[model samples]
Target: MNPSHSHPLRIGVFDSGFGGLTVLRALLRELPQAEFLYFGDTARLPYGAKSRETIARYAVSAAEFLVRQGAEYLVIACNTASALALDDLRAALDIPVLGVVETGANAAQAHSHSGDVLVIATAATVESHAYATACAERNLRAVEKACPLLVPLVEEGWIDHPVTREVLSIYFTELMHQSKAAALAPDTLLLGCTHYPLLREPIEQAIPAQIRVIDSAEVTAAQVAAAVHAPQAGTPAAPRFFATDSPAKFQRLGSRFLGQPIEHVELIDLEALEAL
Candidate 1:
């Protein structure tokens, strides 16, 4: 849908947790004048461990809530939900829905000259095989690795910590070994999880020089910007923030991902919706 420039566009960005703020951060760069409604389903986070049905239910409820709040577009920023419930979200919502997995794959297809790509994401995303499938659809062979610890480390504000760097090194080493074993020459490394972008610096240091890293948040935002047309040169208001639980903590840690101080985050109760 072409958003009218008469007023700021209300774009909804949904994530299992605040990590998706990275996507919002990128979106702000692409469409500075657009109004973003960011919802963090923190109460039911780690959608990675839940069953596919459960994840879809949680994500659909979140999406519906944003739509009710006048969201013209929906961006599924959580990798787990993007991997497992993207189709469910599109089916449940009338507005346009974009998932990071597809965007990441699209970026990988654009960057990979060797037709092989490596994906690093949360365990649930790896289990879903969404990146691999998306990449395959784009005719790019993808090797997915589940780096579960990275999420916690990133949330702990250890983006450049020695331990985080070491962990990244190990994961990249294992991914390279897997790629070699599969007899595929990988030219691109896709950060399949939103949290991974926080560690991009160390991640680049961990990988080979020739292999480029694709930040899913950046690509997803770029694609969304392209879809919604260019950003207008106007003073955009601060984004509206909502969280299922822990408004205080969300405000605290969310700032790290958003790269700005979030003045306030309205606490939302999704229990009634979850019950349905």
Candidate 2:
């Protein structure tokens, strides 16, 4: 069932770090009337490098914290959590849950006539092969590549720097070669990491013109909007922001991803939440 438009909705967005802000930014556009609670597990970030068991524990703790804050729905905005711990979050939370990986795969199925897609994501996400599994379930062939360097580049605020562009060029060139080697005619290039959306312009320039770049963040927001039937216009209050560590850093870096000035961010202790 879709979220009712008649009453204000409380939506929770969780990410390993600032990258998930891109999804929140899109959600703001799609669901202007809904109040948002965004939690970034900055202290335990890059969930990408952790074990699945560990990722699940951290994700569940974060999700529970948001639910405690009255979240009616949860959006797992981190690709690593979505890849490794989505089922854990769903099992642990009573609220409806959506993950970027599924939305992205669904989009690939809908948009790709050739039924072939390319995914570039962090090492953990690629290791899990979630996108490949999801696409194959939809009868689509997928080639996944680990673009580990991109995340650090994004966090370093070098989005459009020439060095970043050259890195993209190298990554895409290798990815295209892999696609060809797999004998797949891929028409859809999925930005498997939320951080990649920030580099969209350069990514588009780096890849071949014929291949469509899918911003997973955009597709996830559209899917949520469609599911909820969110109202078209309402002056949404600024989202309540929570960070596990370094609220100052989050506030400083988050606006770039959110596309708006973050007036404030609150520091929350996850361990303290778990005690409650």
> What is each predicted model's overall lDDT from 0 to 1?
0.92, 0.91
Q: Which stretches of candidate 2 lie over 4 Å from their true place?
A: 1-7, 231-235
What's model 1's lDDT at 6?
Answer: 69
TM-score of 2: 0.96
**Local lDDT at 3 for model 2:** 44
Q: Give per-model TM-scores.
A: 0.96, 0.96
Which 10 consecutive residues of model 2 have the lowest summed lDDT?
1-10
Candidate 2 lDDT by residue in tens digits, 54-90: 9999999999989988888899999999999999999
Predict model 1's lDDT versus the native. 0.92
The residue-by-residue lDDT of candidate 1 on 1-276, one tens digit each, is 664556678899999999999999999988888989999999988899999999999999999999999999999999999999988999989999999999999899888899999999989999999999999999999899999999899878887799998888898899999999999999899998888898999999999999999999999999998898534766787899999999999999999999999999988889966677
Task: For model 1, give the 10-residue run with minimal summed lDDT.
Answer: 1-10
Best by TM-score: 1
